[model samples]
Target chain A: MKKTLNAYSEQMNQLMGKAICLPHGPFSELHEAMRYSLNAGGKRIRPVLMQLCYEAVGGKEEIESFLMAIEMIHTYSLIHDDLPAMDDDDLRRGKPTNHMVFGEATAILAGDALLTEAFQIMLSDALRHGGLERIRAAHILSEASGMGGMIGGQILDMASENKTIDLATLDCIQLHKTGALIAAATKMGAVLGGGGSKEIAALEAYGKYIGKVFQIVDDILDAISTAEELGKPVHSDEKNEKNTYLSFYSIEESYAIAKALTDKALKLLEQIPGDTSLLAEIAETLIKRKN
Target chain B: MKKTLNAYSEQMNQLMGKAICLPHGPFSELHEAMRYSLNAGGKRIRPVLMQLCYEAVGGKEEIESFLMAIEMIHTYSLIHDDLPAMDDDDLRRGKPTNHMVFGEATAILAGDALLTEAFQIMLSDALRHGGLERIRAAHILSEASGMGGMIGGQILDMASENKTIDLATLDCIQLHKTGALIAAATKMGAVLGGGGSKEIAALEAYGKYIGKVFQIVDDILDAISTAEELGKPVHSDEKNEKNTYLSFYSIEESYAIAKALTDKALKLLEQIPGDTSLLAEIAETLIKRKN
Candidate 1:
């Protein structure tokens, strides 16, 4: 799993580096902010999920451009969510946010660029595949990263901050905010790679469960992980007084729930009728991500 | 011109209401903020241009899904631009800005929603036409509204604000800030409707010229029109102390230059070897607009 994740990290950095080097002219600051966040050294779980899902469905590693598209959308959301008016955090992924590094305005536009670039990249990537594949890819990535998906989740997350949430509310927020994108990453790979609707649904369910488990584990980590271990400031959830699963569930309770969810996700993957090692690897690996 | 414009406006309101009405959770505030800006009156120029260009190139008005998309991107830009942290405007389209109406955070997410919704609308819309056309439309809209296009121009606009800018700098800003999306609207319409490269290029040229002309006219209106007449606060150019064609050229000179650009645009439209009255009417309307 570590080796698999490392490969995605290396490829994504190179992909993001290419994006960063693109001529954004005087908007270079905007590009820099986007690059800063993109390269800020997270686990690149979404890209890996996308890659694994593709392979697990009898697909290959050649659909990298689509992975790049999904990652761009993910990066854009992070940049915006970290803005002063949103999460109001000064630190993210162990460094200053786009707004803190570039001015707020540039940061805003930088996020916008990464977002728009995602579609642009998808179109180019899909064009090679032609037909409905490009369209399918666009729709999947858009739903995951856009409103009612990542952005929608961000909206809910922002609204929920500094307030307490019940278990259901926490579940809802976590599902949409983080789970939507992660789920769509795999589902999208399936759909774009021409997997059947049944395969797509199973993959989506699997991704969703794992994504929830991942977030819950994150909450558990926040209750225990050190700043150095987590990369970003560890105490941010408490510092922000944000509503999280940890806020609602005891550490033990959350861990149990997370474990259950991970088991369920693996079970769904098992239903996919393939070797499923890659999907299993990703589910196991994501829950263990430090940063 | 009025018929097509009115037709699109009516459909847009209908679609906007439908999309917004579909529950996006407690992000209702975000949707409302999006609605506030989106529902606020404007020319509905981009989407209409897209439709008109599509129709002109033998496309269908079935492009309704894309109608909201271009508008969403445009509205999001307006919302973000009006942020106290961004352009810091109190008024837009003769009404309070989104940040003023909803808080800054809500407005930001609202803008985020609108932008995301743009893609959502595109995807569903694309599904209607099949993936190939959808991919074509998505690429066009995304690129136009993305970094190399609108956001890039906006970053330049922010950087150049209240600062001395040479003709080259000003032109770069104008091309990006305003021209890109306009060009995208026309070109995308052509692409979706099966426009040839020459036709696409012609419309592309048409869109670019008219976009610049539109901005110059906006500057002129800002200089000469009253608040009530312009529907927003006037003299904002002077207030922001931003340099524009009007600041550089006499009103009469600017008008003449605008007319010449309009002529160039219309000429390009004529070269496409098809009905271009909608574009021509739009060109004429650009010069004739009071605000």
Candidate 2:
């Protein structure tokens, strides 16, 4: 999985490189804001999960474009989440946030533009190649990104801040806030790869489990890492009194839960009736990550 | 046309009413911030256009859900546009902006939740009454709302704040920021109406013209209307030093242009085989409006 991840990062960079060339907003500042966040760089895990799952499921299409789109949406969320009115963070991906450099107004507009542009790219005939798979992919992406999924989770998380949360309540928040998108990524991959309903369902289940693990890790990392090591300011969740997985579980307990979730995700891969090794490795790599 | 419009609004509300009942997010101040702007009264112009075009094209499918989705998208844009960090406007649709009501952070999230909810409503089975038409409608809505159109125009409009814009630039801004959604509305109407290539093309052409007409009227209203009468504060364009059609063209001349564009739209409708009476009446209503 680590070897695949190295390859995945390279592919992601190449794909992001192509998408970055597309025309941006007329406002130079807004464009700069978007560029700053998008180019700041990260593990690019979302798109990688999408592409690899896509390949495992028979997604031989122009997979790069769809991957580019997921990345854009991911970038948009970060840009907005880091805004003064949102997360109020000063740094991200080892650099100043969009608002820190371009001002809040431009940062706001830039995030808005990136979000809209992500959908625009999907709607374009050039990107979709007019295939139903891509169109379906777009629909799934929208569902995952919108209120019933990531945004819904975000709302709940924001509302829950400074409030005591039970384990069940916290689990629900984490599932929607983070798990929905990760699940969507894998589902999109399976569909793109020509996987049938059963296969897609398996991948989606796989994603749901893995997505939980991802968030648990993020919560853990938030507690343990410095801004420099994590590439973003830390201690905010505690500062804002936001409860995450780590808020309730001990570090060892959180680790155990992440491992269990990863195992569940790997188990689901067997339903695909194909080579399940690659996906298990992806799940393992995710659970084992340090930064 | 008025009857059709009233019917469209009713249907859209009825459809939208169903989706929000589901527990998607924490029902708190932030969620309320979104619902406040969303459920507030306004013309469902986009839905009307979509249904109108759908019917005009011999499309008999239930498009109510998709109709609501587009309206939600439009409403979200308005909510966000009125944010302090963006337009800093105190009023929208005759009431205080979301930020004014919920605070800036919650307001931003409210707008975001609405944007996400719009897509969720469109994708869920709860709103999936139109099938293939749903996909087509989504494609149209996404493009219109995305950067290639409305968002693009927004970037231009925001950039134009306090800066003089040329006639061509102002026209382009209006064409996108305001016109794109209108175009989408009409084109969606034509598509759902079962209009073929030629009919869809004609409606789209007409849509572009009326899109211009709608903006001209708004510009005119802003210049002349009082805040009390208009609901929202008036002359906002002038206050911001933003360019408007009225600024680029003489007030009298822009009205002349509006009349001309309305006429062009009406003529295009004639060529498309739709009920010329309804189309013409709507155009005339737009051209002759007092508020």
Candidate 3:
């Protein structure tokens, strides 16, 4: 799994580098700020998931741009979420956040640039693949990343900050904030790989289950992982007075929930008639990950 | 001209309202912030131009979403530009800025949501028209709004603050910051209206010229118009220590320059075989306006 992930990461780094290259103009600082967050060396989970889902559906050829676009969106979200006005985090992926390095206004513009550039990359790449495939992929991605998905989730999380909330609200936050983008990644892979409705539906379900597992396991890791292991500080939720699965339940309970979600995802993979072993492997690794 | 602008503005308000409606959930505040900025009442110049270009190129139905998306992009840009970390404006369109009313964090998310929703609205509308049009329109809009476009221009504007820059640098700032999206609007109208390549090219040229006229006129307005007439504070560029056409030239010279650009745009309109009278009239009104 490490070898596979490294290969995907290497390819993604190259693609992202090319996508973010700005002209030697006056606004080169924007490009630099964008690259600072993008190249900060976290696991390329979203891109890898997109690729795995595409391959699982027997797709090969051109999926690099879509993968790159998804990662840009993810990176932008992280950048904005780390702003002083948002999460107020100093470090991300073991390095200073974009706002910490670039200042507040530049960080804001950098995030905005990344979000806008993601669509440009999708559209430019669409011209290569006849057009509809990239359009459909972008559609799914935009829906996931927009108010109905990630942004919506962020507002809910922000509104409920430093306050107690019910499980339903927590679910709402997690589903929109993280789950929607993950689900979009898989669904886009299915559509881009030419999978039919059935394959798309199955992969979407798999994505949803794994998304929940991913967040819960993240909570568990934050509670236990050392600073070195996690890169950033541990128990950030506690520091921020933010609610999490750990705040509501014991570590053992979080682990059980993650395990059950992973199991459900793996079972859904079985129903899809493709070589979904890579997906299953990823899901297992994701939940058990230490960093 | 008022009647024509009113009709387009009315249609745009409806489309924008529909596009921004969230599915009654935890993100209602996000929705409200977005609506506050969007409904704050601007001239809707971009959407009106887009629709005018569409009509001049003979397009009839299903352009509403594209028009709405363009306006949303414009509104999002305004919202972000008004952030305390950015332009730090207290008033926009005669009312408190998004950050003033909703807090800085929520304002930021609102801007982010509007930008994302622009794409979602385009893609959803595209699905009905077989897809490529929305993708292409989005491509133009994103390119005009991204790093090489509006955001790029903004960074340059920010970096050059309280400093003197040459004509070339100033032109670059204006082109990227304001001209690009206006150009995108007209070009999109041409493409969506089914104009051929020649017509599209002509409209693009027309858009570029009119964009210049629009900004120069705005600088003129800022220099000369009253707060009540402009609906915002006047002499803002001077207060912000920013450069403008008036900074380099007399008011008479600025007016001459705007007239020349408007004439060039009108000449381009002559090449297209559509009813461009409305576009010509708008250009004249825009350049001659007191506010």
Top DockQ hit = 3
lDDT of 2 by residue, B15-112 (tens): 65654555544645555666777777666666777767776667775766667777777887887788777778888777788788888877776677
Question: Per-candidate DockQ versus the true complex?
Answer: 0.70, 0.44, 0.79
Interface RMSD of each: 1.6, 3.4, 1.1
Candidate 1 vs candidate 3: which has greater DockQ? 3
lDDT of 2 at B283: 79
lDDT (Cα, tens digit) per residue for candidate 3, span B1-291: 344667877777776667676577678899999888888766788998999989888988868777878888888888889887888988888898899999988998999988998888787777668746666887899899999999999999999989999989999999999999999999999999889999999999888988998899889888888999988889889899999998789999998999999989999998888788878988888888877
Please provide TM-scores, in order, for all candidate models, with all chains considered together: 0.93, 0.92, 0.96
Rank order (by lDDT, best first): 3, 1, 2
Q: How would the docking of model 1 be graded?
A: medium
Model 3 misplacement above 4 A:
A1-3, B1-3
Backbone clashes for every candidate come to: 1, 16, 0
> Model 1 over residues A75-110: C-alpha lDDT tens digits?
888887878887777787778778887888888888
- The top-ranked prediction according to lDDT is 3
For lDDT, candidate 2 versus 3, the one ahead is 3
Clashing pairs in 1: B153-B177
- The lDDT of model 1 is 0.79
Better of 2 and 3 by TM-score: 3
Q: Where in model 2 is the C-alpha error above 4 Å?
A: A1-3, A23-32, A125-132, B1-19, B23-31, B121-134
Q: Rate the local accuracy (lDDT) of all candidates.
A: 0.79, 0.76, 0.86
